[model samples]
Target chain A: MRNITLSKAVNEALAEEMRLDSTVILMGEDVAEAGTPFKVTSGLVEEFGTTRVIDTPISEPGFTGLAVGAAMTGLRPVVDIMFGDFLFLIMDQLCNQAAKTHYMSGGKLTVPMVVRTNMGATRRSAAQHSQSLHALVAHIPGIKVAMPSSAYEAKGLMKTAIRDNNPVIIFEDKLMYQDKAPVPEQEYLIPFGAAHILREGSDITLVATSSMVQVAQAAALHLAEQGVSAEVIDPRTIAPLDEETILTSVKKTSRAIVIDEGHQSYGVTAEIAARIAEKAFYHLDAPVQRLGAMDVPIPFSPALEDLTVPTPDDVVARALMAMRGELFHAL
Target chain B: MAKPAQKNSDAYLHMYRQMVKIRVFEDSANELYLTAKMPGLTHMYSGQEAVAVGICEALETRDKITSTHRGHGHCVAKGANFKQMFCELLGKDEGYCHGKGGSMHIADQANGNLGANAIVGGSAGIATGAALTAKTLGTGDVAVCFFGDGALGQGLLYECMNMAALWDLPVIYACENNLYGEYTHVSEMAAGALMDRASAFGIEGHEVDGQDVLAVNELSQQLVARARNGEGPFFMLLNTYRYHGHHVGDINRAYYRSKEEETFWKETRDPITNFGDWLVTEKLASFDELQALHAEIKTEAKAAVNYALSAAYPAVEDVTEHVFAETV
Candidate 1:
């Protein structure tokens, strides 16, 4: 295993996939010359030339739909959205067309397309730039949504997403891009709908997604000092959710806290919490608590933004409350 | 010496039959709706038969098409099974989409019938995307988008036009003007002419007399041939009119358009009658043969309605089925 940052792992995966498949082409606003907004695709254009590493005009809906069309015919396209917030501009193509083509066409066509986008509350990118709306896409039927919290999972999940037959949206956390992890040097792919147990404990099961995984891990570490062990579970994908892993963990611990960067209402956390209540409600010793952003436009101010999004402290406090059989209503 | 032209008589006869079939089917559908025999809204395609028939005649069997709400003509002209279409409208288990998609959303992708969208300008972007797929995959296929004059004002249409022009995609933007955009007049709603809009995007455009099936057929042949030869896209604005209300729900006598204008356009600009007159006056076809074709289509449409009515309704459990493909 080789230690690498999450951004480098994605770069390596793209380079390897492009090398293996001639039909694999990358397109986005600044993917070719600018080396991606986060530099996850640095040196890719230099390696693969302009034909493979395409820099499209700032036409999200046009290029995104084009990529879906291309994928439906033969080629596999990796499209990068500079920010997750901009997905609203092209939701028609992504949610309606890309997600429905295979089924609408009565299984006559398949879109083997991968959309790589960054989501987080860090960087103070303001209301339009710092929002995690993967839940909106997860509500759609056909599309698959994956959020990798580590460099190792990034490479594996990206490879799996690219090779998958359906359209997969890979939401990479902006803060986790710089975080390092031991990624295998050899070729590998992390299967979708699988949950990773970041830490094991008997006290409480802290379920998190995207960047919240890191926050949950930090909270678990801090709680370890207080002699309170917390099991952190990172569900890599939200659509094909690994309910078995979450239910099992919650059943064992009898307490749970779901940390998400999106709004609490009808969000991924709410869905997960509802699922837990439906299946493992009897096992829960306490009410299901979710630590997520307040229901509002993500604030631009650093202080207000910090207050809105769930931080490690927020996650820990919530987990501790759940462990103590305390119900804290903060919706 | 030039090679002898293949016997296109059979092909032309088939096209004529299909166009008549669409007109007959639509007329019957309107009658059914008026008699309260059919449930839900029905968008009639009575007077715009030639536009769909002319363009679809130029396409190969595998070439795709994206259609608008008034899409029964396009579906019939492109050789969609009449029974299946009737079944879809009836919301039956044996429907094309298994009762999930009704008249507005009827699709059969196996035969390259991409879909007919409910939104006025929704299919343009999708058609452009489908054409991009064809070009990218080297499929040697083209996609045709059929919309009304109302769609000409939509941003998605312009976006698609710009993208298709920039990439030189294999797409045909077939706009059936029909003189009216819902209740509003096209002249009042549209900012500029459609040909000017296409020119602004650096795409070729043509304005055709939609009543003349031969003119549209000949022009579309050239455009489809160009697309097949890998030379960009074509936009054709068919100047025509609908013989019925915009939708079945709005069949009031007095609203926006005058009775005189509707009568003048319908009586003078009827595409089927014009085509039939040209066939007979020019001695290209006989009156008896045309009557026989019309008769055959009426019988076929009746059979389709019977088939649809006799078909079973889908089980309640099947409502949740096919939300997504099971495999991927």
Candidate 2:
């Protein structure tokens, strides 16, 4: 196993897949030469050439819709949406067209496409660029959504997503791009809908997604010093969520806190928290807690933005609240 | 090559029959709605039959097409049968999409039809993407994107057109300028010249009489060949008129258009009637044969409608089935 940066992992995944199959093509604005603003796709155009590594114009809907059509045909197009916020521009093409084409065509058509994007805050990019908008896509029925927390998860999940038959959108936390994690040199794949257990404990269950997985792990680490055992579960794929794993973990702990970067209300945290509240209601603990980004446009001010997203301290405090049987949450 | 040199009488008769088939399909679909038989409204392709038949006749079975909401003409022209189309319209089991995709979303992939999108100008990207697929896979196939005058208002058309031109993709952007975009006139919606939109991207542009099947067919053959030969990504505007309103339920359309204009198109510029007259004049088909052909199609349409009306819907247990494909 080699400790590689998440950006390198993603680039490796794309390179490996492109080397394996000629039909796998990459297209996005600046993806070919500039390697995207995030630089996750650097060296791809060199390896695969322009025919496979395409640089599309900055038309989100245009390129996304094109990816959908290409997927329906023979090509496996991996579209790079530079930011997650731009997903709104291609809603009609992505949600209405890509998501429904297979079902609408009564199983006759398949859109084997992948949209690799980034989701997170703290880059001081402000509202439009920093928002974690995976919930908007996960709400749709047909498309699959995956959020990778580390380099290993990023590479494996990406390879799996590229091979999936349906339309799959993957959100990689932009903040974690340079972060190093152990990734194997030999090819590996992380299947969708499987939750990865980062830490094992019985005191409380911390169900987190994407970047929140690291936050939960930090909180777990701090809590372990305080003689409290916290289990960190990262739901790799949110759409086909591993309910069995989450529910089983929550059942053992009796207390749960779902953390995510999206807004708290009607968001990923709310959905997971509500599920724990509904299914494990009889497990006798404090109410299912949720720690998500504040319900406001992500602020550009460093001081103000620091208060919006849930940090490790937030998870520690929330876990303490559940531990103390405190039925109330604080702002 | 003496008597008008148009001796392909079989092809002429087939084109005539296809036009009649579209007319009959819409006429029967309108009756189905009026009699409260069909569940939802339908957009009629009555006056613009020639554009679809003209462009599609030039394409081989390997060629792909993306259609619009007003798509029955394209569907039939691309060789979709009446029974399955009626089944799709009536929401029955035997429909092209197994009744999931009704009139607005019918996709006959077997006939190289990508789909008919409900969103205005939605299929532009999909069509261009298909061209990209053909290029990348070296499939030697061309894709035709069919959108109405209304779609000119959408940015996606220009975006895809720009990409198609840049990539030199084998695609034909066929704009059926029926003069209206859902109760509004084309002049109110589109700015500047339509052909200039193509020239802005350096893509070749052409215009044809949409009601003249021969004219539309002649241009379509040349464009399709050029596209296949890598001299492609052409845009053609077929000037036509809509015989019906925005939809079948849009009966009171005097607010936007006139009865005289409608009558003028139906009487003098009807694609099927004019084509039939030309066929008889050129000795391609006799007058009686054209009449018999129309009657035969009408009878076939009647039978298909009856079959679709009696066909069962998908089973209740199958409601949640196929939300996603099981495999690639």
- Best by DockQ, which number? 2
TM-score of chain A, all candidates = 0.97, 0.98
Per-candidate clash tally: 0, 0
User: Tens digit of lDDT per residue, candidate 1, span B1-328?
Assistant: 1121242556656767877888888877877787787779989888888899988988888898888889899988887888888888888877777776788878877677777777678777668867876776688898898999988777778877887887788999998998788888898989866689889988999998887777788888889989988887888989888888888777874777888988887788777777677667756689999998898889988999988988998888875565545444
RMSD in Å for model 1: 2.9
Among all windows of ten consecutive residues in candidate 1 chain B, which has the lowest summed lDDT? B1-10
lDDT of 1 at A290: 78
| B17-110: candidate 2 lDDT, tens digit per residue | 8889999999999999999999999999999999999889899988999998999999999999999999999888899988999999999999
What TM-score quantifies how close candidate 1 is to the native fold? 0.94
The positional error of residue B206 in candidate 1, measured at the CA in angstroms, is 1.3
Report the TM-score of candidate 1, chain B only.
0.95
For candidate 1, the lDDT comes to: 0.83
Question: List-wise, what DockQ does each model earn?
Answer: 0.37, 0.84
Please report how far candidate 2 places residue A119 from its true position, in Å: 0.9
Q: Which DockQ value does candidate 2 get?
A: 0.84
The 0-to-1 C-alpha lDDT of every candidate, in the order given, reads 0.83, 0.92
Which regions of candidate 1 deviate over 4 angstroms?
Answer: A19-23, A46-52, A105-109, A327-331, B1-7, B35-37, B326-328
